[model samples]
Target: MKVHLLIQRTFAGLNTEYTSNPAIAQLDNKLFLTDERSVVMQITENPVFSFAKNEKWTCYSFIKRALDREKRAGFYAVRLFISSAHKLTNVKDCLLTIAQRYEFFIQNNTPSQEYTDLLTQINEKAIIEKERYTFDIESIRKGTYYAIATAENLEALFADERNEFVEKLYLFTTNIDSKLLAEFHLHSIDPLSVVKWQINDEKKALDKLWLENTAIPVFAKKLLSLQGAKLYFQLKGQQEKRELTGTNELKTTALIIDDADKCITSLKINNTAVKPQPYFELYALATDTLYYTLKNGKEIPLPITAKLSTRKLIVENSENALAKLWVNGEELPIPTGKKFEIYALTTDKIEYTIVGQAGKKTTVNSDIKTLSIHLPNRGQTINDNKKSPVIDILLYALLSLLVGGIIGYFYRSNTSEEDISAIEQKIQEKEAKYEQVKKELNSSQILPNNTATKTVTSTTTNTIKSNNTTTKTTNVATKTTNTNSKTTK
Candidate 1:
């Protein structure tokens, strides 16, 4: 379904300057304008039509029209352009190859009637878009791919090389009715519509298909084919519908999503309401995974099962929008009572902030998950209770010491001269009193006092030589006078 070509074309010279039409003078001048600002030679078609046909030119419109003509061979021819990655190089031989592939596909497109029936009855929820409906037969480790497309896309499907079509047998297996098929065939649709296609090992699903009650020959043949001829007798032995235990009564069991991250509120199995159960008995079948919503307003997927076979089960959320309330770790049901619940925060300090949202009032805690705060309500953080009272006493003592130091510093720095003089006088008087006490203590001391002591002394001198001299002179004068009186008187 692929086209590979080695195309070769020969180029020839022209006679005219640019265009075939003379009226388009501007275009001719523009096309022929050169880097030197002068009009270059324009290309003219060969005089003979055959000469022109053989010649190749640098003209886009001409090439496009010729290619368009080539593509009109069929939708397959045009489809080559839709999937233009291949250039879809459809020469004479490439066109024949595409036709052959189309023939093979039409011949092999048939599927079993059961498959067609299954498509006709498939649920809309199960039908996938994007050209193909994928059926996962997980047990058989196989998948079936079906598509609805135009004849062009169908041919392109082959060229697409959808994986290697090995011995596994690449074919379309459909389960839609003839009416839809007719519609698909009659019109080349933009949005193609097709039915479901079941994959290989599809026989396992027949257990839920009501095969036991069907008496049709085709159903019987299908059963034989699925069981295999070697085990036909063994399968026949187990075919009889025997009620082993009619005494086992049906019980209601809650469903849960086995392993899911998302919370589901409205869940439906075939379409009745169901809840989640932590544990279930042996008589349960897990058919669907559903979601459960908590009071914290979180949705999670939980696996679901019924104690008895349910024809239809559905779960829908019926709670109000203001139902997001949780205490401890558990989520509570929606609160519509007269009184609201209280919360005890473990933090020492809490702040309340307000934000304006359009015209509505928004608080800081409005978006808080663990704790909820109502407007006009104050919050406080929890303080540590383990600190000793001795710390307070130590702090008070340090404060007193600091105050005393500050007062002493100010007394020294801001003292007046009068105050300094009075202090100096008082210091002098105290020093005199200390000296007097020191002398008294020296006189009364038992140990020898080595202090220095001072003592006072006086001396007198007399002159008696003058009186003796005067007496001697008077005696001599008297003796002389007596001698002279004896001589002269």
Candidate 2:
């Protein structure tokens, strides 16, 4: 793609600045700055240029207030020209995108960085050799050139007098904007005989002729050559915000950088281990599925492609470690190196517990392709064995005293032979008191247990569409069982 930007300050009615691919259009250096003594041309070349004369043209014009207008109110008129080998279907969008960018440079009073970069590319292309053409009777191709002279006069100029009386020649000069001409006369030795003969005595005519002879035609030809070429434009915030048109579904390249641990045996894509390189520039459609094979040979499909641009994919194994085996509705076991897995299908609900010093538990469902899990060190149990011996002695002494008192009461009741009703009431009261004391003692003790329990529940989300509306149905399966068990000795 090629571009030309021409900006003019309205108050001064002079060209303020221009940024162009020199191949598209070359202008005099005096036109760049606000110099009153400079001989400015009034003609503004059509902003849009087309290769073939009849080609449809699309370009943009903008009138904006000057950034600094303390002395007088003035505006800047900007003209934008774009050309390409492909038809630019999105011309308005491209122009708007460039306008927004150019406006920023104007506001900042700085030159366009994009134009600078384009010039660098142009310079590099200039180094390569290309075919050249000379303007002469023998070198000229079968193409028409402007001429004001009559057929007889043109024939006499190129005629070989020794061989023929007159040479057969042609002249096409009708409605040729002769005064609005350029250096179309330079190719011939006596160009003035054909071009200069008509332009004289009029100051305006001379000026127009000079302007036409400049690089304006080159710019027009550049645009014509790209009549049907297509162009694409992307702004900073466009990617994520733009609707998915599906037009750019073509394959895109992405550079993958694996900053994971070197201990990883392999990182496979499509069941093949990725070769070690500085980075892998994988090419695939944005919607295409690529698989990441787990250690257990389970393949997880991930879409890691981008469109129109090269994206960066960074893989850090320690943070995004894949589990050797992942079972729904079960506690996730962290590998020896404090690594855990946290990724599941978009509709899957995964619940896992990481038993460590803090005993962490969480339930999660991921919408993205990858998820990271960081596990801390496993939990430990502290046993107070020294206090256990003392507790055992106290328990035995209490049990012995309770047994002796019950026997003494039963013996005294039998020996005394008091009222039978009174004796029964006393026995009931004593039994109730003893039960309460035992309950209180049981509630006061705390013991350490080296066991972890996890309840697992698996859930799947399904969308059912009957007609226009979509209904979401969730199915859940629960498993209640102890994951880890240890009996105290």
> Which candidate ranks first by lDDT, i.e. highest?
2
Query: Candidate 2's residue-wise lDDT over 1-489, tens digit each?
Result: 344555555444444555554432343322222221221112122221111111122123344444334445444544444331222232333344555666687679785446555334433442222112111122112221222334345333322121111111112223234344342321212222211111111111111111112211111111111112221222121132122133422223353433232222234444434543333344332443565533323555666633111112121235333333334664445455533333333334554443342344444433223333333321111111113435635654564455445544554444222333344455456446645655664454322221100100000001101110211111111111222222321
RMSD of 2: 28.8
Off by over 4 Å in 1: 1-291, 295-379, 382-397, 408-489
What TM-score fits each model?
A: 0.19, 0.20
* Candidate 1, poorest ten consecutive residues by summed lDDT: 454-463
* Native-to-model Cα distance after best TM-score fit, residue 114 in candidate 2, in Å: 40
The 10-residue segment with the lowest total lDDT in model 2: 452-461
Superposed Cα RMSD, model 1: 33.2
RMSD (Å) of each candidate, 1 decimal: 33.2, 28.8
